[model samples]
Structures are given as structure tokens and as C-alpha cells.
Target: MAEELRIRSNGDLASALEDYLAEWSGRSGIAVEIWALPGQAVSRRVAQAVYATVVEALANVERHSHARLVSVAVTTGKAGLRMTVSDDGAGFAVDEAAPNAARGLTAMRAHFAGVGGTLTVNSVPGGGTTVTGVVRAG
Candidate 1:
């Protein structure tokens, strides 16, 4: 499950991530909040991977979260890159009861796996969903 992607520079990655959020995340009528660390830092490969996962998670939120408020956040440190996309909609079980239900999370897992990273999805059926990822700095 290796995903091959061109590594983008920090500035380019930052811009790309923001643009992706603007076009894909916010346009869906779900509010988005971005919190990125200031300064030129971290690996672009990891940044892109994290950004892709965030966008995908937000996409799922937009498509199904039924939530008016969806939040996307990014944080980086020597520990690694952390991102969370959460919504206030009624959530579903992470179990595979239906096909494609977890497709986004699956792709997210693969995306991070391709970079020696990890993806975590938490959902409470009547509550909401939260997808988080952590990829080590390269």
C-alpha cells in the first residue's frame, strides 16, 4: 500500500494545503479552522502526506458529517506532525459494516503508511468523528 507522491517544499506545501482546504474543505459549507506553526520548518513530504490526510478526512466530514462546524487543525514539533479533523454530526461506527464507509480512513492509513506514519480514527455513533494522523519528521 505504498503511495508515491512528489515531495513539495515547505512554502509550496503550506500554500497547497491552504488552497486545498479553501477549495475542498470550506466550499462544502463546513467551517474550517487552520493552525499551522509559523516559520520555515519540517519535511515537505511529511507535510504533504499530513495535508492530504486532513483534506480527505474533512471531505468525509463534508460529505456525511451533517455538521455545520468542522474543524481542521495542524501542529508540528520534533515529536512529529499531528492533524485532527472533527465534526459535530452524528458519527458512525468505525467497524466495517458497509463498504466504502471507511474508505477515506483506509486511504489515510495507506497514505501515512507510505511514509512510515500512523492514522487513527475515533467515532462515537451518536456523537461525532475524529481522524488523526502522526508522521515522523524525515
Candidate 2:
């Protein structure tokens, strides 16, 4: 990921993410369906934040979700940049104070906050998990 980011600095974010997802899917043997990605370029800070959040979200999915499929979406509009990573896996109780889960969530939130964005996570024991982030347009 560091190499990819270095090579893609200030380049096409969508393309870079697509490449990374493809590689990740192949290695993890987990299917990833990218629903959307912004076509235009975004600031380096926003791009890095979004990419890092996605990476963290997928890492959690691989480590805990026990999911067969994951879906990702990112878009830029008047409201700003929005991203969502959803997994069809064995979701856990969101209210439970699990140490590892808390740490991962905190890291994800920090990544977004660094870019002046906000992150939200939603999950149900029997359902799935969704990590949503939004960065309002400046």
C-alpha cells in the first residue's frame, strides 16, 4: 500500500483503489464488488485518508467478518466525499466494549478526522457491518 500510494501521489484515486482492491481480493480470496468511485481527482489528503480507511476496514473484515463478500463505494459530490465499506459477514454487537474492535475503530476514525472527515460504523450480530465516512466539501 505504501508503494502504491507513493507511485500514485496526487494521481487518479479511483484507479489506484481499484488496483489495490483487485490485488487484495486475489490474495484474500474474498470477492469485492466496487459499486462506485469518484472519477475526478481529489486532494492528496482526502485521497490518503479515504484509502487508509478503506484498507483498515477491509483488514477488519478479513480478520473478523468471516465474510464471503464485501462491497465498497466512494463518491464525490457537492456535499463532499463519501465512502462506505460493507461486508456480509458475521457481525458482532456494536455496543460491546471489545478492546481490539475499539482500537481498530478508533484508528479508522482518526484517519478520517485527520482529513476533517467523520466516520460511522454500523453492525448487528446476525447482520453485517458497514463503515461509512464523509468529508464535507470545502
Q: Which candidate is the best by lDDT?
A: 2
Instruction: Show pairs that collide, candidate 1.
Output: none
The segments of candidate 1 whose C-alpha lies over 4 angstroms from its true place after superposition are 1-11, 37-40, 96-102
Q: Per-residue alpha-carbon lDDT of model 1 for 4-31, expressed as tens digits?
A: 2423443355566677777765468777
Residue 83, model 2: Cα distance from true site in angstroms: 0.2
| Candidate 1, lDDT over the whole model | 0.70
State residue 84's C-alpha deviation in candidate 1, in Å. Answer: 0.9
Say what the RMSD of model 2 is.
2.2
Q: What is the C-alpha lDDT profile of model 2 across 46-101, one tens digit per residue?
A: 88888888888999999999999999999999889999999999997777455345
Model 2 TM-score on a 0 to 1 scale: 0.90
lDDT of every predicted structure (CA atoms):
0.70, 0.86
Clashes of each: 0, 0
